[model samples]
Target: MIWTIKKAIYRAMHGSLKVMMVLFNLPEPELFTGAGSSLKIPEVVKSKGINNVLVVTDKVLMELNLLEGLFNSLKENNVEYKVFDDVSENPTIQNVEDGLKLYLEGKCAGIIAFGGGSPMDCAKAIGARAVNPKRSVLVMKGLFKVRRKIPPLFTIPTTAGTGSETTIAAVIKDPDTHEKFAIVDMKLIPIVAALDPELMVGLPPHITSSTGMDALTHAVEAYIGVCGNKLTNENAEKATKLIFENLEEVYKDGLNLEKRNNMALASYYAGVAFTRAGVGYVHAIAHNMGGLYGVPHGLANAVILPYILEFSRKDAEEKLAGLAIAGGIGTPIESNEELSYRFIEKVKAMNKNMGIPSSIKEIQIKDIPLIAERAVKEGNPDYPVPKIMNQKECEGIIRKLLP
Candidate 1:
């Protein structure tokens, strides 16, 4: 009788979940990333029928000339291109405005963003806004405004992080509101994502570590998310395995192209996974933290990953246990609930091993109430939190981390 009742409950719950799944209308970007063939930027440009290209990058990349090889490729293929390497780490609306100015001034047919998330995101906004100046980038937030027939976009990620190349979402800060808003649109998906591990060899250790954590966060969130689809599961598993294997090696030695390649693949896989499944409380809160403080997005995510995962255990125990196994922690002797705790511990250990700090004390969340309120308001609050976090509970969590 008990077993029959349990089965009936399970069926009813799953039936409701299936109903919800059909309603959200998720999106998944087509992924094209790997190593060895990452040097085919010119081929990608040609395939897109691109005549002139605007390469978006950072001033640091320009100084390092990390893109010399790509420039040579453009020259080798007799491809006409303009360089717009003025973007910053966390790009502002003005950056997009400036890049669009250059895009129009050069009258370029396409854009090639050849850097980390900031540059890639900037390029997407510039690409989208260029096609329809009538529709503001801010107004295009949330799902599916990326439909405009913009020029072709080629993204070559220099960092084995961000996975921005593989995601349809572009994050740009609004100066008026000071929020790191996300523009999720299929049209923002790059026409081609060129993955070259050689380009990541120049990344410093700090960046490599932070970005690896970012990749890990994506995988963790996607694997256990409410909207996690089977297709996302396939990619998330690959990302989890690759990140577990290669993140340490890349941190220890950034010049190892093979390790960099694997890490790059991990980031790409996680990006693909989360682009559809969507991230959870960690990302939502981290986004707010980034907006309020000048915290690096990856660092902010890394800091709160374990905390959020611990809180999420109440709702996602089985999912967390699954993550544990994927993260190489076999099922422990305890219940699945305990296994979830083990998973959280393992993640904490991984962060510590990778030199990621535990708290936002570095960013100094002195005003705990303010940070918590903003974290919930700018993030979860009424947006349908996956785990149902109340204000006091959220503030309590933030306060606990302050020691």
Candidate 2:
């Protein structure tokens, strides 16, 4: 009875949120896509009258010399830039602070987030700190707490996952507590995004597989969630179709720029869907896994996705069936139940094909309680999930991930 009341309250809150979101008039990032599109961002920055900019990335990308082209392009555009490549896989508050220090000291007029979600998230938080110097990122947690506009922000997504390039979210971990929390505000959306497949041509197979699944999770969650509007539904469906068709193909042949570009667009579409409609337990559980076990976000999402779908399958059956149809994996002749089951099975098969583990080896049994607690806290009253879960239920589902 108490759980029933809680769900009612959550639904009511979500209803109000839908109204608020419409009032917010959320903006999508102006996108530049295709081969060598990343090179165009520097020119856009210069056109915006930004003379100096900060580039946020990670050491792995820098080591591979992926940024060399971007750097040279910036120079050719006569745009001075500073580099902060200390962003970890799961970005910490310290990463933001360190990057903010560079942005301030260099007097950067804007920020260019280069790489996957981590650098983009760190850059967003740094920009948040830049504009609202008095507000700690801790205080900026939850929805719409950012007081002012962030600095002019641009994103170049090297991986077609996380959709951080178009998202209004930045997930940051507290190193002290190991708790990962997202700071969500419409102000966090980037001013521009470049979906350049040229940059993703060298992505390792593991990254290609996991991040592609991350985009799938985003599309699935957004489509099934109750908060979806027509726009979110359409974007999610298109993203689902593109990911289903192109992710594995690109995974096997990373040099296929067309497939890579399709995956990139799919990621952006999924990002747009979830940014508006919201994600569910897949994200909630995945965030905790990343926070506690130092697991890669995409890998965590990929592994946990099948389990969450099974749990929510009954409730999300119609939605799943629709997605299965959209993804070209089902026909109208199939019943909703059959199509839903097929969708979940397809996800499992994809994980197997890509060598993604069904269970997380890193999830310690001792930490299950804390993991479940945080996941429920992050999910409830916020994510408009198809079905609500209690702590005990969440714990049970997470336990299955133990290897």
Q: Pick the candidate with the highest lDDT.
A: 2
Q: Report the C-alpha lDDT of model 1 over 1-403, residue by residue, as the tens digit.
A: 7645644554454445445544645443334555545568776687667778899999998899888888888888777888888887778888998999999999999998989999999999999989988888878876576669557888888887688987878988876776778888777778678778888888888888888889988988878766677777788888887888888778888888888889988899899877766676677677766676668888888888888887878788987777777767765555788778888887787789888888886446556676667666544421322465656778877765664
Q: How many residue pairs clash in each candidate?
A: 0, 0
| Candidate 2 deviant stretches above 4 angstroms | none
Q: List the residue pairs that clash in candidate 2.
A: none
**lDDT score at residue 77, model 2, on the 0-100 scale:** 98
Cα distance off (Å), candidate 2, residue 214: 0.7
List TM-score per model, in order: 0.89, 0.99
RMSD of 1: 5.0
Top of the candidates by TM-score: 2
Q: What lDDT tens digits, residue by residue, belong to model 2 across residues 17-53?
A: 7888777778988999999999999999999999999
Q: Which ten residues in a row have the lowest lDDT in candidate 2?
A: 17-26
